[model samples]
Target chain A: MRRSMLFIPGNTPNLLMNGDVLGSDAIILDLEDAVSPAEKDSARILVRNALKHLHYKGCEIIIRINPVDTEYWQKDLEEVIPLKPNLIMPPKVSCAQDVKTVSDYIAKLEEKCGFEKNTVKLIPLIETAMGVENAFQIAGADERVAAMFLGGEDLTADLRCKRTKEGNEIFYARTRLVCAARACGIDVYDTPFTDVDDLDGLYKDAQFAKSLGFTGKASISPRHVEGINEVFSPTQAEIDYAHEVMETIRIAKEQGKGVVSLRGKMIDAPIVERARQVIEMEKAMFGGVEDDE
Target chain B: MKITANAVAGTLESSDVYVKVEPCDTLEIEIESVVYNQFADDIKASVKEVLDELGVESGRISINDKGAIDCVIQARVETAIKRAGGNK
Candidate 1:
């Protein structure tokens, strides 16, 4: 249900206070790239206090901790894990070992804090060339990895290429990640659309990602949430077609027919599965309230 | 815990408060806030609560607030006290 996860700077109190009301499905309280080194401790304390005192309802709470390679990550985890955010996003993940390292630490912390095992989940940010190469292994590294987030800006830099609106450079990596995550039976998220002002480009980019099997997309700006959610959600026509597919299947089963066809085309297992997914998505999004056709 | 040297935390940004702590002979707290007329007592109470939780005594605590809530004030105070070498 994470169609859009917006990034809110961890140190900015003003933004942190209003994060849940911004229409994002999830709000990522960022401590990695958003806060400066000098203010890392301050930001950590502020974020911890915000989580403890403020009630952010409806939206999932994700804390993007600093990379495992840095000294700040341990401190970040120590402060946030006890509060039990929905997910902890580890950046610059290069391999399965990186995921294991963070997951192992979380397991230890969960025990020490007397919380249920695997209470905190991980969303590894795959941005390096090595990470893309080992996407499959990383996706299946641990049980705590709920999803994989593609960080296009960092990935392009790691690839030694310039990022563009067309996103041709990241095509291979994007497809590879999708295939890996799908094969592992986990969700995959596309990177944020960096150009906040260009709504047209954002829509096209999101559409392309959805076509390539991205379950959802991250957003750096609040303005991109609606467009991303719209792109990922099943359309009215799709929902109606799903309902027809299910109804036809039900009728075929009751009639003792060996085969079923909808609109003169065979409704096979694959089509039925896709229709089920569409129907499930519609239910989740609109609470099973069907719109007038 | 004691404040051995001067330390500051937080920024004067909107919805934030700047906290500074230093060594003093007796406990002293000074607050200058945009919402002074409305929430000065609550702000002082939050600062004192954090200091008490950290076991901080005998220090000069100063707050420059820009309408920060109680949590923000407490966090800033805690961070400043920690930076001043206050161990709890």
Candidate 2:
């Protein structure tokens, strides 16, 4: 999961172009809520052209299309999915069956388009209370589903509550979303910090979200990407400590020692696993070289 | 320096080297030549590292193997990137 997924309003070409230049690991060309219905088709064409032509190396491209249940969805899918983006973030996914529908269409489209089967994944966003209740079923509906994102502002509106600074009102929903995703073995992403100028606030919120096991957060502004990445990245100190712990364990095992201590802390199963996860995440987050098989 | 070549993945009857320069979003240069299996993996890694070090991460990259030397591989990639206005 990326530390921050930068979202570009679908109608702005310059914003789309800056997505790669601004250093976000992933860029979402949003067509659903950010775009007005009057400009939705134009937004689709713009996003399609960008996907087919833009030079965004190593940036995962996600297109947030309109809800599948809407009248415009099929055309949106037909026009954009063929471009073969990294993933499609379907909004307002209500159940297992909802995701399955998109998954089935994607499979057929891959065959028809001559792209690799299952090359594109689905990110079903839970934006309503009903969707939150059905989160597990929705997340597990497709094998190609990668992550579930909490769409808080929309969700709050649906729930008819004013969102709080600490997000206390949405705590239950956030925890529920995380549990559902984890139960189904998928990643859960937190909603963006809407206040782009509030860098400290964004960092605090992102850190809090990370503590709660949300893998990453979304960003509304390009400026937010750096801060989010900073919060999520393993500092050199952490990385080095993890490496030391891992090496100590390996050495101790080679020496046939049942127990090992590194810097007064016992090296054990959980610690070793955490270290390994850190390493793996670093590899995933950064474009580490993997031999093409 | 100008480069023009294309490569495909398959066995080569004799050792051959083909190169090309095309517009690539991420591929800097790709070399497709038949190489000894024992050295193929190492050669690919070395070439990728060199390209990465040179800050050429995006472009059309296609490599066809024909059992070339490390020197030949370096020369070919450098030649191709230079043709694409990359630092020679």
lDDT of 2 by residue, A175-262 (tens): 9989999999888889988887888899898888888888788888988899888888877787777778878977887899999999
Each candidate's number of clashing pairs is: 0, 20
Docking class of 1: medium
Query: How much lDDT does each candidate structure score?
Result: 0.93, 0.74
Q: What is the interface RMSD of each candidate, in Å?
A: 2.4, 19.3
iRMSD of prediction 2: 19.3
Q: Give the runs in model 2 whose Cα sits over 4 Å from its true position.
A: A284-293, B1-88
Location of the lowest summed lDDT over 10 successive residues in candidate 2 chain B: B2-11
Each prediction's fraction of true contacts recovered = 0.79, 0.00
Q: List residue ranges in candidate 1 displaced over 4 A.
A: A288-293, B86-88
Per-residue lDDT of candidate 1, residues B1-88 (tens digit) = 7899899999988999999899999999999999999989988889889888988878999999998888889888998899898442
Chain B alone, TM-score, model 1: 0.95
The lowest-lDDT stretch of 10 consecutive residues in candidate 1 chain A is A284-293
